[model samples]
Target: MYRTSWSCQSRFVIHRTLVAYRTKGMPVPRPRLMLAVILFAQFVIPLSISGTAVALPEIASTLGASPTPLQWVVNGFNVAFAVCTIVWGVCSDRIGYTRSFQIGIVIAALGGVLSTFATNIALLDTGRVIAGIGSAAVLTGAAPILSHLFHGADRAKAFALFGTINGLGLAAGPALSGLLMSAWGWRGIFAAHTIVLLLALVGSMRLPLLGRANTSLRQILDFSALKAPKFLTMTLVPMAGAIGFVTFLTYLPSALGAIHSLAAGATGALMLIMTIPVLIAPVLVHRVLERTRITPTGIVAASFACLILGGVGVLMLLRPDLPVALGVAPMILLGLGFGLPLGIVDAEALAAVPAERAGAASGVINLFRIGSEAVFVALFAVILATVVTTALPGRSGQLVASGEHGHPWIYHDGLLAAGITMIGIVIVLGIVFFALTRAVSRTPALGEQLGEQ
Candidate 1:
């Protein structure tokens, strides 16, 4: 009787284990719809970022702000974006992905409404800061959730799609801002504040939520994530990339305006040209990498070299004497460098945490990206201000202050200096990425376990 009772219990426990395994693996998702929605949510914040750029001069003039203060108009939002990303990343890990995204969108909308009514630059910057915080939440939460939604080829494709949307946001921001400005002056750009948030809100409602992360909150927030050499390389290299990215793109529009003697409308068109290549690179890059069977690390290192050369080219080509297309040629290399690493680093971030902790990991990395961009933008602005202050006579300064005058040569020179700075950063970024890739070969533990999920 005792033996029989023990046998029965063993069979029962085994049966329960099999059923539990089945339940855990159940319900794969549809790739197409999932990718689309995630991409759409990601697009909102970047759109808001670039869309407001074209209207900055008008905003500066109307607010009676000087050049240095006006540059903060952009920095304020990006700073808040950086500060809040890690916080939101943790929130998404604790609460859930879909719900966290919804909160972020809501916060962005609130910030946007406040911004559209600003009486001066300070209030306007306040609105931007608040909106940035909200954007950080949405951005940090979205990427990790996508990692959960798809895997393998499907996952790679989703990343490609995400890349495309990011490209559009970067490319379109200035042109869209200019279009709105043409129709209704600077305030028109603020109109997108309502638009992107509304779209993000709708998308959030439809987005599917995933399982809770398995880690304790303390583990999720700790520095362990960055302590590993590979992870550290992934984190810091991207920061350098971001510094280069903002240093170029943020000031490019202002660069073009001065060079071509462009009207706001013409300047917007050129901004569109610089950004268009980003959308196109992902498809080509994925195919090239796959067909060549090339390692991402080698490509990333090579890309840095290309970007350094290309950045120099843009600075030199950003001349009154050169054709407009020549100035934009350098961006092609920059955009190519940009797309690959973004996808790879994003993957690195997801792989650093356990499967259950993807949301939290994503939040951390996204915060890293946002914080880096914000600081870089602020640094670039400060640098530009210092250079510009000494370069301009008081009478010349007032002309720039008016928003009606143009300074194509001075803009080019300032931009050349900015390009040199980015190249210096790229050298450091390259060293880190290269070291991390080599580390992965030795730490098979890091590489092998990453894809196990």
Candidate 2:
């Protein structure tokens, strides 16, 4: 009896010691492994985002889908992602991050499998919506888990790394998808996503379960952060940025292919020239912002300046007589404009909220970012279809053929109209952004006072 009692006491002592170690800021065990799993999972979302760009032309041909439905293939996912991100973030807080993340991976994998085997566009879109919801769950859970694992300089570095990986995924997604599609066909892209997600899921099983916030569902759903000017502007800037980013990724490959007759792999490579800058600019911008102590408002002003340059570049693409080499130059400016602000915006927005509410904060920001992407993508598709149908009346065969083998000029009119529309959006957003900056500068404590509430 004494022996058993002693054994129980010893176990209790060890348990208390372990708890104390964790509470006292002892390093997370297997920190590197945990980061790797998180990074890998995070990589999947953007990969699926930009990667589909290269495959859209193929999907349209294979599924006999129209331009509008093809747009849905991308926007369907964004819609689901936008709507569910907050719910998933709140769910993670309720259930636990590790479990939510694991379940997300499983659901995403199932969605991928369904997409890979789909024989029709509806099934494919359904799969995309499911996969998007799963991806949102993974992304929402990841931010807080990353916050929990690191601190101070380590946390900053982790977020920087996160931004870099996200850019890399966005940059590499098209090129990689193109190469895979060239080798194994379009379904191969979905297959690859499924495989990578499963591997990340397995790696995540080893992550230590973290504690949850004591907040209620009502509290998690509270969106009073939107009332704060600083937070609202931060969220709005990303939404504007998403319009440019999504337009470029969703349509650029097809536009290039339709106009230049470039193969999928080659078009994907060209896309890299625009996207590679996204990977490099964020780190440099983060360092510059740190040194200059620039306000987020100032940072956003600079971002919009770059976006204006990019919008001009898109407009230049509409010129009928421009050299192809000169035409692609604008993309570099567009990329720089987009890339420079990518990392800081999310961090700044989350900073405005208290730490316990970070997940909900992230969800609200992304909801706008992605929801805007879906709306703009659909709108752009409608614009393109309207112009094409009107211009090429009684030429249904030519409209169908335009995606693949038609003359470059066949798409010129529609693309020109869409380009003009995008430029208009950028201009409107620029005005709104600058106006907000002025308002905040006038009342310096306005943002702080609102956030404190």
Candidate 3:
């Protein structure tokens, strides 16, 4: 009896010691704290992007801005974001990731402050552009930081969480912005953004220390990484998502209203059915990786297949004879198709490159992701309008493009052609994806090179 009592006491002491060491070892384990900071900052970036649209009407009303200036409120930020991501990516490697991240937070906070108090439309647009430039740094800096901080499976999970947070920001942004606008007016959104970025700047101090790239300017500028078949393929995966899923996401509301005549509130509510899968899919994919022996290539293949299937299923939306309820399942499929590969592709793309160039690689990959979303969405709209023009022409086609009252059959036909075209692009991308994945796995030299890094 005495011996048993002693053993229990000994075990208790050991457990307490371990707990103390963990607590005293660092102020909240670096990984968890840093991940929190990164995720927090990442969440707000997309939130600002999507949520700002909700404020546009209010912004125009208060500022007395014309349509052209009002449009730049969104476009200016996007143009800056796309252009600066590459700049910040290369800069992060030169100055250091943590430094670049903090600088971005500062810049973003400044932009947010400017936007919050701006009296004129031009000032607000300039503030947004500045914020976008800052956001580019965060996006480019965050990935490479994670690439270096976590390795193998941990890296996968970290990025999975990263992607999940991004989706949440995008999905939740408009609603949150609307709520804030109701309570504190349009400036509340930018004020809230500034406050969050300030907090993120504080948290960044605790990030794990990492060194800047020692590579020569020529090496840093080397386009060789882009030449790798595996690297190019991994980069294209997100581009596929951008074209196949995001383009639809951007245009779906118009389709809903023009085709099925859903009200704004109803359309927003129905969108949740599709968006919920995106929020949960990264977690699900992480579980699949943890439990199963599925290779990354296999995961990529399955995701692309889901996208193709979802694309076909969404054709049901173009048919007026079909129930709107029928499109729900396909929308969910499209969410899964995009979400499943979100983080996995980031990890895979980084792994394909040398460690020293991960920062630059991250910039390029994001450029494709953001650039494609912007470009393809515009392209898809043009295609839809062109198709509609052939059938209905002039004002009717214009109304169809904008989802105002128009010829339902003509709009349906236009959407069908655009959907079919998008599917063809995704299919071609899938074939290319497969060829590249196979090539990467077979190339021992590439593996050895990455191993050396």
lDDT of 2 by residue, 364-435 (tens): 665576567656766676677677767665445234323453656756667778867877787788787777
Off by over 4 Å in 1: 1-38, 89-99, 141-164, 206-213, 218-225, 321-323, 347-361, 393-404, 447-453
Q: Report residue 88 deviation for candidate 1 (angstroms).
A: 3.6
Clashing pairs in 1: 50-173, 258-408
lDDT of each: 0.63, 0.70, 0.71
- List where candidate 3 sits over 4 angstroms from the true fold: 1-31, 48-71, 90-99, 113-124, 144-160, 171-192, 205-211, 215-223, 253-265, 286-295, 315-323, 347-367, 378-421, 438-442, 449-453
What's the count of clashing pairs in each model shown? 2, 0, 0
390 in model 2: Cα distance from truth in Å? 4.5
Ranking of all predicted structures according to TM-score, beginning with the best and ending with the worst: 2, 1, 3
Candidate 3 weakest lDDT stretch, 10 residues: 1-10
Give the worst 10-residue stretch by lDDT in candidate 1.
Answer: 1-10
For all predicted structures, in order, the TM-scores are: 0.79, 0.83, 0.71
Per-residue accuracy of model 1 over 285-314 as CA lDDT, tens digit each:
667778997766665675676667677778
Please give the lDDT score for candidate 2: 0.70
lDDT of 3 by residue, 16-100 (tens): 4346547768543345667799988887776765556556546755874354455456656666777787788778888787788
Q: What number of backbone clashes does candidate 1 have, counting pairs of residues 3 or more apart or in separate chains?
A: 2
The better candidate by lDDT, 2 or 3, is: 3
